[model samples]
Target: MFSLKKSQMFALIISSLIVGYTTTMINAKADSGYTVVKRMTGNNANVAYHLANNSKNTYLWNGIHTKAKANLRKYKNYSWRYYGKSLILSHNSKKSLYYYIQGITPNGNEASKIRGIVWHSYLTPGINPNYKQLNNIYYRYFNTDSEYLHYVQKSPSQKLTREVLKLFPNTHLSIQLTKAADGASPWAWASPRVDGYKNILEFPTVQKYFNKRFYKPNISDNTRFKLIKAGLDKSYSQTKRNALTQYQIGIYYYNNPHRLIDDEAPGFTIAIPE
Candidate 1:
């Protein structure tokens, strides 16, 4: 019979118990949290899928294509992990596909380029206006106007154009207003100085000017400072904030739904089963 010292035996038993408990706890925690669902390369699917699937109601940043692809491999085939309200996807690729989602009313023609294409036109039912020609028009008008000709000469619109290009670099601004009830005449009065064109100016040119200027660099230091300043001053209005919040919430929920769950971690794990 082998006789072991009481103190030594007791210590061994306690150490074994502690090890067991720690292992159990770690495993339990790992099992209780979120799970990864699908992972794929850029060659597999579009970013829209992930945006449409996340449950944390988070927004995607602009230019997230590489991150999305890296995430594909990191969380391959529905693994389990802990993710808070959001997960950051990262990648090493040069091409990124993240974009800001926006909804345009059929008749809002603030952006000259998008006016004919994206604005409410009979030709395209739900399309928003394109800004290509409007951009060209800006340059054209800038060149022709003595007051703004300096902008045209220096291509002040370049910064704004680059910003717009970020949204859709390849987008074509080819839509024509020829289909309007007034035909091409609706577009003939693109300039405010042109008389008898007040009907076509129903849409605010100031709004369009701001829209174009929004894409420009150092807009605050440039021609649009006054308008932007004025808008910012009024942005605190309850009505405006409420509307903005509502829109943000709608977008958040739309992008993140309950049905899309990480396979490893389920929604039930986060919220107590009620």
Candidate 2:
């Protein structure tokens, strides 16, 4: 074997380091998988995931692309590297249920189809025990067309929250705050329309109402509840949902009561004891 020059050796070392870093990141994401399925299906409410054509040997790249027609000799026909294996797609029908994938490459490029839908079996189930699952059957149907990815963002929900509050001026926000102060999870507080039930149980109707009010799919019931839950417990334990352990949620509610309704802002306000 011949020896390399100093400059060549340095370049080789840098290339190895770069490749190692990239591999580590990809392995971390792939091995752990993602909790793309948010388990908070409300009765008759729309969920994030829907059944689409099954993916067979489909590759999910760090970007999006369909099978682009190109000269195989001139360009690389497929992605050089992909994070997930056997990526699938959901049908574009308005009536079908779809899955919500977090932390994906945004703004689909021309190279590939949006990789929103993955193999249902590939995902880990029962990650969220507090919420119920939605009805969806997984089947591998080949998609004939390019796919598009869509999701609910915060501004739209905030607009809906503002609109609903405008229609129903009187809500149990104050009472809910009091309950939170008295050692109740904000999600644990129930309303009169619902029989002493709070949180995920109470959110479906609200989700349905907002879905109609907003004239589009709002966030999932579980996701919406968790948003509120997360806002309350933002700075505290990343795991536990209790108010005592994470006083930040109490503070968030006390100061920014509107945040609970507005799905975007996070503050420690409502229930913190002075």
Candidate 3:
């Protein structure tokens, strides 16, 4: 055993406490259960693409494709260690297939991208999209805007609907639940699809209290701040942070379960599992 001076022992204890505090403050998450990702490279893209296609009922991953600016392989870096389910778009042809790739980076979470047509041989199968709870969370909060979520009015109807209507002339807004097309069940619509619509939909206190661009918001602010921070900080990329902020805000709505406005306009609908 080594002997330490009193000052040295104190310093060592301080260092340990600092490390412990840092570890506790870090926004670490449990494994999200998205396990099918393969480490990919230029050399293996062809194999991976083919494998993914053969495995699942692939869909366009429209959300990612909409953001992919150009060819994914050319523009973005792919990681082997951290990847989510690779997807094949609906429109596959003889020569090429479109893919919504779950690109990985040095950061923890996978990044979504749209890779334009590539040789079918490159596609590699991974997680079944149907089984991807991570993707479903992404789809429900981001892709579908919490499409069928129900909300009760928290504050008196401030006519938030009329306010949004003035901005979006073609849009209709309400909080009523309508019978499904098949009339088998009822669905509620309250989420918005347009750009910058969230700010309008939010209660003034909630929106102002958790502004991301202007000020730093954290759990100390309340559960609302905690959820929002957790959602945005969950991703490293700024773009991803913004996209995920919407999902976090959705969580806030879920916990609060009250809305200033309701969803009556039907742009699209899907049955999301709770």
Which portions of model 3 miss their true places by more than 4 Å? 1-142, 145-202, 220-274
Candidate 1 lDDT at 184 equals 18
Model 2, runs deviating above 4 Å:
1-4, 15-100, 103-115, 126-193, 196-259, 262-274
| RMSD list, candidates in order | 22.6, 18.0, 19.6
Q: Per lDDT, what order, best first?
A: 3, 2, 1
lDDT of 1 at 59: 25
lDDT of 3 by residue, 177-261 (tens): 1222111111322442323223222222223333222334333335544443444345333453334322222222221112111
Query: Which of 1 and 3 is ahead in TM-score?
Result: 3
Model 3 lDDT, full chain set: 0.29
List runs of model 1 lying over 4 Å from the truth: 1-50, 55-69, 72-188, 191-208, 211-216, 221-274
Better lDDT candidate (2, 3): 3
The total of clashing pairs for model 3 equals 19
Q: How well does candidate 3 match the true structure, expressed as C-alpha RMSD?
A: 19.6
Q: Give the per-residue lDDT digits (tens) of candidate 1, residues 1-274.
A: 2356777898999999999988854553332222223233333111111112223223212222211111121111111111111222333322222222222211222221211000011111111122221122211111112222222222322333233212222222211111111111223335422222222321222232333222342344235434433443454333433333211000000011221222111000000011
